[model samples]
Target: MTSRYTLFLCALILAAFNLRPGITSISPVLQGITRDLGMSSTSASLLTSIPLLCIGFCSLFAGRLAHRYQSEKIITLFIGCIGIATFLRFFTNSPWYLLLTSLLIGAGIGIVSPLISGFIKRYFPTSVAPMIGVYSTSMVVGASISIGMTTPLQHWFHDSWKIGLGFWCVLALIAIPLWYTVIRHPYTAKQETVQTQPASLPLQNKQAWLLTSFVGIVILLFYCFTAWLPAIVEEKGYAASYAGMIGTISMIAQLPATLLLPVLLRVIPGRRFWITFFTLSEIAGLAVLCFTDITPIVASVCLGIGGGGLVSLTLLLPIDKTNSAMEASTWSAMTQAIGYMIGAIGPIVIGLLYDYTGSFVPTLYLLIAVGFVVIVLGWKLTQPESSQLEEQTVYQT
Candidate 1:
């Protein structure tokens, strides 16, 4: 690989890293945030859910925006928005204000989510699979680091939860200048512009939607686990800090899976086999989580293995099913938007159930059942099919 290509890949990876840390960083600090703001668990869960809801709804517009303007420019502008949103969190005292900020932050991430896959397709055409693997791995590393550090950072800042939550803005700020350099370089601009309108509306293709739905289901499961697992562990008699650490461990386990899955794709045919295997692995993880009161460490590792693999597989699906990066990006956005909308319900529903029933058992059971549904939907999605007619029929005014 040439030096220029290598640097562009690094920039792409850095961009991926910035995407999720903002969302995941809040989980570990939820207790503090709730306490500081005098909000209920339901409201705190909204803090997490609002971004997810925005990610789902805002993603539909990303393709249009990318078409109207350069993706690099859109990415840089929204990333700056994310930094500004994070910084603004410090001044808000009301739950509604925080929720509004969440909407802004979510929109910023929603816009960038689809563009990353498209960028990979444009710049690293020959290396799509591996580059995506690298991207997913970088995202996992960022999420893990954020989950692991937020608590300590809170302690360091004299137990100021605001400081812990606000520190993640630094990542967004750092990414802006790097994104600027990547977008401004004439050579990089030329390479990206060469394929500006690559086929992104894979939703118009039946096979693409099948693959997309499978990817979406996986995302639904991934969001459920990430958003609620810490709280679930806390229900199992662990401290909030320990539960947060377990969430961190679950995210960290994705490193190996993300790094290895792309290579595995080289040898694996029949995408169904890989999809079914990981979907069942996720079901098993949730099953273990539902039935066992084992040590937090042991349970967390089991859940982590499944959770990490599930997310990695979801990200990998776009690359596997599509022939071009534009398709992958479009599918990524559509799936994430649709799936995250579904997944956003998990934490809120779980919180509501706990509120009414005064127990987490029913919620855990509901999640386990949802895992089974994910497996069924995932299997159907793994098939090479598309929904082109459906999309066109719906889109035609």
Candidate 2:
């Protein structure tokens, strides 16, 4: 398309990239934060869960925010808000203050999540899958870099976790100006309304629910793995830093998988086959992770492949199921809003299991169960065509 359109797409992807790493980065350094703050594992777990909970709840308001204000403006403001929240973490010692910052950061990130899909639908109508793939890939890159660097940055700054954690604020700040430039251009602001056609509700559409459930399960698996894998590896006798590095490596695997998925979608008519393949891959990867005492490097490769593929497929489902960008965004919001609520529970449940059993086996077993559920849903979602029913949900704006 035009240079302007290309630039806008880059801006959107950059924004997407910024969304997750900040949150994920904290997990790697949770030990440091826990030691410094004198917190319990349950409290540490809350730090991860609180953001996810907010993301799920706040996503419901994302569409309304986009409707009331220009989406670009809302994105810019919230990203700036993210920067502020990140900066605040460096100064806080109290868990309450940290929790409040988590809420702010999570809400800011949540507002941007659904809007990015909607923005893509509105701006790059024909290129949704590739663009979203690129977006998802960027997110993985950012998460990898953030997690990979946390320990080194902490060491470099004289073991000051605050400085290590605060470094991500700079990335958030960089996104703001790029977002402003993109949103200011008239071409990016041309508003197009979706033609509303009444039909059956998306929830009533088995295919749509299947797609949503697939995304939920994938996210559930992904978040649980990210939240606990480091500790799991540590339990297996690896260093904390090594465990964190493995998590980073696992996140990096998404880059290739996400980039390839869009191309595959074009060649493959039925999404179910691909979904089934990836879901099984996820199951196999988790099985290896649990059953094998392989080296950290080898196990990480398996985990990364499974985690990356699952996340890429989750983002791809909305675009695959919808005919237009509006439908895609709406479906994305609904699925993510509902699906993520379920996914957010994974880490907390895993944490509770760890506390009760004092072993990672229960958590691993739970993940394996989630993987099978995803396969069941992915099999249904892979159907060659959209359902005959139309979505009946009302757009609140």
Candidate 3:
């Protein structure tokens, strides 16, 4: 790789690192945040769900924003938004302030995530799978570290939850310089001659909606369980620390697969077997956690591997199916916007069910049913080999 590609590659990996740690870090210590902020179960659920809603809403405009302002600057600015908001967590003792800052953080993440996808498509189209693998790997590493370390950090900070949360701002500090370097050189090929700009979103296309739903299902499963998994584990008679580590397992397990999935796809090309197998792993994992108490470790690892693989697949779908970086960005932004909007329901519904029934059993069952839907969708969404098509109908914007 040339120096430019190497620098941009570093920037992409580092930026991926920032997008998730701040979000997943909080889940491990969510109960503490609630208690400290005086949040009821319902309000606490809203705390997690609200950011997802912001991510979804702000993501809808990421493509246009990047087009107007340019991708590199827009990404840097959004990462700036994330950093500032993460730092502000140091001062936020009130639930309202937390919510407000989370809104800003989510907005940054929402915008930056798709742009990162676009960046990869532009700079590394020939090696999309491996680059995306690196991207996904960085995210999971960040996420797993935060979840695993938060409780210890909280203890080290004398049980102050704010410091545990605020410490993640350093992620942004690391990312900003790397990304600044990425856009400083003209990385993306100038596509001025191509008619890539769309008249409107291609929501009317069946494939577009299919891609949207595919990611929607993934995010719904991801955010919902991530938001509440620690608390649920604790309620299941595990200690808080144990629950937190177990939660970390679900995220850490994603790393190997994130690094492996791309290579596997290169060898195997079809997405159905991978998606179906991992989705079943998630089901089995969740079922083990819910129905039997025999091996929580095994269950957590299964869930992690499954959820981690989906992250790779969902991110890949837009790029795989689309023809150009601009098209990939547009489809990715749309997928995130629509999918996250739908996925945001998981936490609220799980919270309401938990509060209403006084058990997480119902919550687990609901997630399992959702997995069945994911299977059906994954079955259809699996790309038929290009060679299999007599004539292709490409999704156009």
lDDT of each: 0.74, 0.75, 0.82
Across 1-397, the per-residue lDDT of candidate 2 in tens digits comes to: 4788777877877797678866888878888888888887767777777787777777777766666667789889898988899888778777888888888888887778877877777776666667777788888888888888878888999998887777888878788988898777746355566444422226676666766677777877888888878888888888987888888877876677777777766566445666667666666667776888777666566667767767776776666566654566566776777777778788888878888899888788778888788877765555345442212211111
How big is the positional error of residue 273 in model 3, measured in Å on the Cα after superposition?
Answer: 1.2
lDDT of 3 by residue, 237-332 (tens): 989888888888888888888999866765665678888988998899889978897757888888888999987888987787676767788888
Which pairs, if any, clash in model 2?
Answer: 272-382
- lDDT by residue for model 1 (1-397), tens: 3766766877887788778877888888887778878887777878878998898888888877877777889988898888888888767777888788888889988889888877877776666667777888888888899889988988998987777777888888778888887787623443432464544565576666565566555666677678778888888888888888899988877777778766666666445566567666666667677777657666566566666667776665665555554566777788778877877777787768877888777876877777677677766654344322112111100
Count steric clashes of candidate 1: 10
Count of clashing residue pairs in every prediction: 10, 1, 0
lDDT, ranked from best to worst: 3, 2, 1
